[model samples]
Structures are given as structure tokens and as C-alpha cells.
Target: MECPCCSGKPYEQCCEPLLAGRAAAASPEALMRSRYTAFATSNFDYVWDTTDPKYRDEFSHAANCDWMSSSLFTGLQVLAASDNGKEGTVEFIARFRRGPNPEARHHERSRFRMRKGRWLFCEGDVISG
Candidate 1:
């Protein structure tokens, strides 16, 4: 499959390793990038698979698909990532365009958890507009 990030690469070369359970992302920022790719492609299975099961329901793929399908995710800029190997945070801005809007930014601080050598998305705290 093509990369959801539109980086002119295949998903296998871009984010598939992380999404397919073949490897754990090297850092929180990398994991966040792959998650954004998952969102852009409406790959609910990957989204569900990478999330901490406790927070899996936080992403309602069916409800999200409508908006997700309509928008084109342009890029991701990671601002910061910190903490140790087990717990980390990543703050990033995702750029997307929907209909008449040229492109808007969605910035948030996302939390990650590493359990048994695998990284899982916990939740995100949206900081601003």
C-alpha cells in the first residue's frame, strides 16, 4: 500500500513495520508519525492494534472515517519528545486540508507506553487551537 503520509513511498517502507508488529518504533515521535499515517489512510485496524487496549475505544474508527476520508494529511512536525524508554511524550503538529480550508494544524501532546518491548499509544492532550 502507498504511504498515507504521501511521502512518495510505500507503506512498508514508511510506516508498515511499526503498524504490522514487525518492529517497535525507536522513539515516541516515530510512533506518532506512524499513527498519523494510520489515521490518514483510515487504517482502523492498525490504529486499534497500536493503541493500548485500555484506550483502544478512544478512537472510534467508524465515526472518524467520515472526516478522515474527506481530509488529506499533508505533513507532521514533531516539536518535542521526552521521558525514558517505558513512558514518553511527543508533541506534534499535523497539517491537513479539508474542503475549502487551505490547510489547518492540529497540535497535541501525545502519550506513549512501552510494555514488553512494544510501544502503544495511550492518549493525547490537545493543548491549543
Candidate 2:
């Protein structure tokens, strides 16, 4: 499958290791990249798997899948990433095109949790439109 991060690489060559339970992301930025790829490919299982269990039930996989299908993520630009070994944060701009509109950007600050040596998505705070 195509890379969900819009990196112009196949998923296997890009983020598959993280999604397949073979490896954990080394940083919150890497986790966010993999998460974006998961969303693009409609890999709900990976999305759920990479999320902290505390927040997993809050994710509506079907809705996410539908939204992903309807929007095309054109690019990702990571602005900053910081990890203090256990917890981390990533700030990024995701550019997407929905329908016939021009690309729109989502600036987000994402929180990450490291549990049992794996990095999980905790949540995100939208910093700007």
C-alpha cells in the first residue's frame, strides 16, 4: 500500500514495521508519521493498536475510515518533536485536500505515551486552523 505519511514510499518500506507490531517508534514524531500513514490507508487496526488503551474506546474507527477515504492527505511537515524517554510530543502540519478544494493545513500538537516500551498515541491539540 502507499505510504500514509505521503512520503511517496510504500507502506512496507516506510511505516509497516511500526504498524505490524514488529517495532515501536523511537520518538513521538515517528509515531505521528506512522499514525498518519495508518489513517491514509484506512488501517483501523493499526490506529487502534497504536493508541493508548485508555483512549482506544474513544476512537470511532468506522468514522475515521470514512473521513480518511474522503480526504487526501497531500503532505506532512513536522515542526518539532521532543521526548523525555517516557512521554513525548510532536507538532506537525498535515496538508490535505478534501473534494475539489485546495489543500488545507492542520497544525496539531500531539501527545504520546510510552507504555511497556511501545509508544502510543494519547491525543492531539489543534494549535491552528
Candidate 3:
């Protein structure tokens, strides 16, 4: 299956390894893409695990899973991305639908950092919805 991150690559070659714990994301944008894939595939634990420990408690697993379960993730568009080796940012719009609701765009700029040789999501600023 094509990756939901719109990478135009097979799932296995794209985000699967990241989500499966077989490999780590090579860059911040790659981590962002894989996180979107995790949401799309209901791999909520992966999302939680990949989050920075200091900020992980800021999110509730139940809430995150509930949102993921209720929404049908359709696609992801990375608008801008930058990396400075240790810290990075990715701005993106994730498209999704819930029940009979119209498709919605979740626009955000997410921050990530490299810790212990693995990329971890730090936080995000919601740009629009």
C-alpha cells in the first residue's frame, strides 16, 4: 500500500520500519511522516513511544487513541521542513474526516529533537484547522 504520508513509496519501504521499531527515522521530516502514518494505521503506541519523554506526559494515550480512532486519516502534506542536526521542525497539513463531517485540514508546525540517536517528537503548534 502507498504510504498515507503521500511519500509515493510502498508502506514497507517508507514508514513501516519506523512504526515497527525495526528502524529509526533518519530525519525530523521522516519522523513526522511516520507519526502521521502511525495515526492513520492506529499504531497509537508508536506515537506515544516516539514522543520526547519530558513532554510525553503532556498527552494522554487514551485521548490520542480516541482521536485517532474517531478520525479517518486520508493524507498528509509536508509544507516545510528544516533540520539542524539536533533539533528540527516540520510544518504540515494532515487531512482527515470524522463520521459525516467534512474533510478537515490540521495544519501544524511540529518540533523534534534527536535523543539517544533517535528522533523524538517534542511538541507542535497548531496553525489552523
lDDT of 3 by residue, 1-129 (tens): 888889999999999989888999999999999999999988888999999999988998898888999999988999999999999999999999999999999999999999999999999999954
Off by over 4 Å in 2: 1-11
Top-down lDDT ranking? 3, 2, 1
- Model 1 residue 104 CA deviation (Å) reads 1.2
RMSD in angstroms, candidate 3?
0.9
Question: What TM-score goes with each of the models?
Answer: 0.83, 0.87, 0.97
| lDDT winner between candidates 1 and 2 | 2
Residue-by-residue lDDT tens digits, candidate 1, 18-80: 777787788777778888988887776777777899997677777778777888888877788
Top TM-score prediction, candidate number? 3
Show pairs that collide, candidate 2.
Answer: 4-37
Error of 3 at 83 (Å): 0.5
Clashing residue pairs in all predictions, respectively, total 0, 1, 0
- List per-prediction Cα lDDT, in the order shown: 0.82, 0.85, 0.94
**Clashing residue pairs in candidate 1, if any?**
none
Runs off by more than 4 Å, candidate 3: none
1 against 3, candidate with superior lDDT: 3
For each of the candidates, the C-alpha root-mean-square deviation to the true structure, in angstroms, is 2.7, 2.2, 0.9
